[model samples]
Target chain A: MSATVHIADVVKHYGKVEAVKGASFDLAEGEMVALIGHNGAGKTTLMKMMLGLIRPSRGTIAVLGENPAAGEFSARRRLGYLPENVAFDAALTGRETQAFYSRLKREPVKDALALLDVVGLGHAVKRRVDTYSKGMRQRLGLAQALIGRPRVLLLDEPTTGLDPELRQTFYDVIQKLAAEGTTVLLSSHALTELEERAGRVIIMNRGLKVADGTLDELRRIARLPTRIRIKVADLPPSGSPAWLPTATPYRRINGHIVEIDAAPDEKLDLLRRATADGSAVQDLELIPPSLDELYAHFLRQAERPQ
Target chain B: MNALITIAAKEIQQAIRNRWVLAATLLLAGLALSLTFLGSAPTGTVGARALDVVIVSLSSLTIFLIPLIALLISHDAIVGDMERGTMLLLLSYPVARWQVLLGKFLGHLAVLAFATCLGYGAAAVALLITGSSFDGEGFAAFAAMIGSSVLLGAVFVAIGYLVSAVVRDRGTAAGLCIGLWLMLVLIYDMALLGLLVLDQGRNISGGVLSALLLLNPADAYRLFNLTGFANVSLFSGMAGLAASSTLSVQALLTALVLWTLVPLACATLAFSRREL
Candidate 1:
């Protein structure tokens, strides 16, 4: 598949500080990628570069086959961006704000206003933006970004002020857009929220991209142990099972339940041994490494002295 | 072109909603009506046309009031949007940076023009309603005063944009705009007068004085509307100064136009290079 957004060795320098340091990545069409990073990890800076708000100190960025920072970049109409802590003219009503953006995007005002309903902001269409809550304003921001059916959407900390239900609605809209072949690159500190939705993740720390892959690929690369919990009718007298594999250590949770950490390669062997006879094992549970754990592991790995 | 109009329309809508249009119009109308009645009272005794006196009074008013209004509306144009985080999202669209700056300039200019016409136009209408007699020269001068007033306001608006583009924050821009107003409208003339007094006839020639007057937009505006017409100049006591000075009407207008364009161009250059 063709890359919808390309960044090659892009670096941003604000004086002596390096916001993004020689980072390179390409997002394919219809790919939903989560950019997870800390506060100063260059996430917003990277997104701004993609939107052409700031020029890179080095390298190049091509979005939809055009230089976004060029004076007459024709691809800008096909791009949408929602800034972190998005703001609007307080004097303007929700409908007017939508219409203004629609005109700038050269889209139909009728169609753009329809997005307000999709984002659950139809109820406050006539109200001034200052009267809307933070979440409502965020929804309005999202509505504007959805205008013109942009092929590339860059959202920086989009869900910062959204409630759980609103966040669900936001992701639903994003998923629908992505499924329709829109490339999405969103940055957020909320890892659990993106764990299930994003097909791929890019982890950045201290101005560098530490990891990028699907969840399973990251798991294979990190080699982090999976956890297995066994609930038997009873444990042996010594609180250890005789049939359990001895290579990996096991911890007893209670009289009937015991948990063991199995390496990626040894998970099947450990599971088979635990349920071999079916007489000792009453029930079994398997837990893979979580996004939170993977994020932490990758950050730690990137911080290590090389 | 469409994007430019969209942005400009948004600005006009905001100004209307925020009551900037009403406040500016009301302020100009109130002051103008007062000056028209009070300042034109001596017209009968002085044997000058009532409309000519009104033109002189309103031109002086424009020198002070119009610049302040322009600066007040424009000082925060660029930095304010940047602080509000709207400029980021706005620039992300297909619109160019210069388009944003120029669109806003046009919008604010339109607001200023509307207010100047209606407010100052009210004063002229009041004169006609009061049964004051005036010739075509006086009427033409009155029309020129309103037009030049808007041009003066445009000069300050462009200057405000320059300050807005250069400053890091809104507070700084506000403070700088006030300082600029005081310098150009109040201080520059005082300092120039002092320089002329000190020089007597030793070194500062008429050409140098004309250059100095052209350097400040307020002074250029003052020279244009006050002295450009014979009737208004005779009534305002600027006929002698207008004759002695070598600066022509076209020169003053050119100076005002350059004042608007130079700073506007500088502001666009500055904003295009700005990080956020």
Candidate 2:
């Protein structure tokens, strides 16, 4: 599939400070990509470049096959953006705010108003935004972003104020949008949340694209250690357990809990040996490297000299 | 065109919802009515038309009050939105930056115009209903005063937007806005008076004097309303200068229009380049 958003060697500098180093990535159509990073890691800057809010100091960024920052307002119709700290006019009601954006986008108000209900804001559509709670305002922000059924969505920390249930609904809406061939680029601090939702992960560190691939692909490159937990009746003799391989490294937690670190390739081998007969291993769990570990591992690798 | 109108409508709605429209209308109407009734008391003794006296009083009032009200409503139009993070989301849509700026100017201008018309128009109506003799020239001068008053407010609103565009924070914008109002409405003439006293009309000719007054929008507005009509200029005590002044009525009106457009254009340029 063709890329819905493309960035090539794009560098953004705010005076002497380089906010986005030369970064390159292509977000495919209908693919949900997660941009995982810490604060000031250039996630917001890169998204701004794609949205045409800022131009790159070097290289180029293309959204929908056009330069977004070149002052062509019509090109942004297919684009949707939700800022990290989105705010609406406080004096206007929710419906009024939605109507205003709809008019600006040249879209019909009926469908945009319908989005208020989809985001579960039907009951308070007429209430002033100053009276709405943070989460409700977030829902209104989401509703505004969803205008025009935009084919490209760039969301920055969209789920910040959402509760667990609202987060579920948020992802559900994202899933539906993606199913309809929308390209979604989401930046958030919630690693586990994106772990289950994003089709691929792009890790940025210190204004650089550290790693970009599927979760498993990143794990294979990082070679980070997987975890293995085994529940046993005894403390596994403090150091060596007869049921486990002697060369493998492990530690005992308590009288019943023991934790083992296994290499990526050796995880299966270690699990098989521990659960050979279920005689010593009452309960067994083989945990692969999570996104959190892989994320930290790639961040550390990027910080190191080549 | 639709986007521009929609933005203007939204601003008008915000003005209504915030009670700014009501306060401005009532304030202008109350003051205009009081000026009409009280300023007309001297008409019988001074041999001036009652409506003509009202026009002069209202024009003087417009020079002081409209700019302050205009600045109060518009000093934060762009910078406040940018600081609060709404400009980011607003620009993410399919609207150009120029459209946002122009839309806001038009909206604020409409609010000012509406208040000016309804608020001051009530005074003209009251004069007609009080069983007074009326002529076409008197009513025409009253209408011109209202028109020029709205134009004066537009000038300050544009100036306010310029402040909003260039400043980094709302506090700084507010400070600069008040300073601009003081300079244009209060201090420009005061400083001109000081210069005239110092020069004693030797260095400053009548042509230079008229050009100097044209520099300040309030002066331009005052010249337009006070001198555009014959009786009003006599009552305003500028009849001799109005007759000998090189600046024509069209020239002063053009100056006021430029005062509104020049700053608005500058603000749009500054806002177009501003980073959200």
Candidate 3:
């Protein structure tokens, strides 16, 4: 597939402050790529640069082979953006707002109600935006973005106020859009939320890109230690057989709990030895690290001195 | 072109829904009606005739109402969007910045046009009912005056958009627009009068006076329309100067066009560079 978004050493600054420092990435077509970063990590700033709202201080960013800051309407015509906090004119009702955007895009107004229905806002279609709850407004925003069935969709903090069910619905819609060959770029601090939905993830910290890859690829690169917690009825003395040599073992979060991290091969050996010793291994668990841990670990590494 | 019209339609929808705007429009219309009724009453004096009264009220309103409405309508066009975070959504579309500015100006002009015609039309009907001298020329003069008022309002609509684009907040946009109105309509005219008086004894017929008139849209509009009002020959001297030296169909058209162009150009430029 062709690359839909290409950023080569893009840097953006606000006065003396560098908002996005030497950022670079490429997103292939039909990909749902999540951008994970903390607040003030330049995630929104980078998104603005991609949308051509702000010119980069240096370097190049091409969204569908066109520079955003060049005021290239051809590229924007195929693009859809959902801002972090969606706001519409309070004077207009939901349908009016949707129809306004539809008209701006030169699209038929018939699909607006359908989009609103998909976002579960069909019942309140005639209510003014000021009367909408935060989540409802976000749904309307999503509907607006989906108006023309754009080629590339940019969603910022899309799931902030959504409940689990609505969040699942949002992911389903995104997956459907991706299935139709649209490139999806999602930026949010919800790493766990994205971990399950995104085909790939790009991590940013301190105005710089820290890592980018699939979930497994990021796991391989970070090489972060896995953590397992077990519950025991009794305590073993420190530095005894209770602590496996091949693994790094630690004491309980609770008095009866023990936690350990071991290599793949040694993991079974450690569990076998614990049972073989006739010690009460009432419960055991083998846990892999999650994307949040990986993200935090990489962000720390990025902040560390070379 | 369709996109520009779409934007204008949306702006009109928004302005119509503004309660403050509706209230202000109703109040102004009421004032126009009441002034005509009072002016048609038996004056019992020489200078208090119906035509004189109608001209006084209409001209005074022209000095204040047109610019005030234009500023109120457009002073928040851009800055309000920025504050509400809606500008990002609009800019993300495939529209140009100038298209947005022009669309907004047209929208505000539509509102001003509707309000002006309604107010002045009511005044005309009230004068006719009171058995005032409602001749064809009188009606023609009133139309010309209202035409000038609308064009003048359009100039300030552009100016208000520029102020909106420059400021980051609604309050500041409003403050700047009103300040600009005060300077151009009130203080700038006064200062020009002071200068003309200071040069009263000298032979000072030059481009300096024409350039000064161009500096104030309100003054330029007054010169354009105030020439026909009797007893207003005090201003007719400056009007004559502008008409003889720099005023023509082409020059007046150019002046009106520049009134739309200059502020709109600044607004679009500012909007292009704004982070939103």
Q: How many steric overlaps are in each model, in order?
A: 0, 0, 0
Model 1 agreement with the true structure over B1-276: per-residue lDDT tens digits:
998899899999999999999999999999999999997787778777889888888899898999999999999999999999888889888888999999999999999999999999999999999989868878889888999999999999999999999999999999999999999999999999999999997999899999999999999999988899998798789999999989999999999999999999999999999997
Off by over 4 Å in 1: none
Where does candidate 1 clash, by residue pair? none
Q: Summing lDDT over every window of 10 consecutive residues in candidate 3 chain B, give the lowest-scoring window.
A: B230-239
lDDT score for residue A166 of model 2: 91
Q: For residue A274, give model 1's deviation from the true position in Å.
A: 0.5
The TM-scores of chain A alone, one per candidate, are: 0.97, 0.95, 0.88
Instruction: Tell how far residue A227 is off in model 1, in angstroms.
Output: 1.0
Worst 10 residues of 3 chain A by lDDT: A238-247
Query: Between the candidate structures 1 and 2, which one is better when assessed by lDDT?
Result: 1
* TM-score for each candidate, following the candidate numbering: 0.98, 0.97, 0.90
Candidate 3 deviant stretches above 4 angstroms: A230-239, A252-257, A263-283, B42-53, B229-253
Residue A179 displacement (Å), model 2: 1.5
* Candidates 2 and 3 compared by DockQ, better number: 2
lDDT of 1 by residue, A17-93 (tens): 99998789999999999999999999999988888889999999999887777765678888888999999999999
- lDDT (tens digit, per residue) of candidate 2 on A118-173: 99999998899999998998899889989999889999999986899999988999
Best-to-worst order by TM-score is 1, 2, 3
Cα RMSD (angstroms) for every candidate in the order listed: 1.1, 1.5, 3.2
Question: lDDT per prediction?
Answer: 0.92, 0.89, 0.81
- Candidate ordering by DockQ (highest first): 1, 2, 3
Clashing pairs in model 3, backbone N/Cα/C closer than 3 A? none
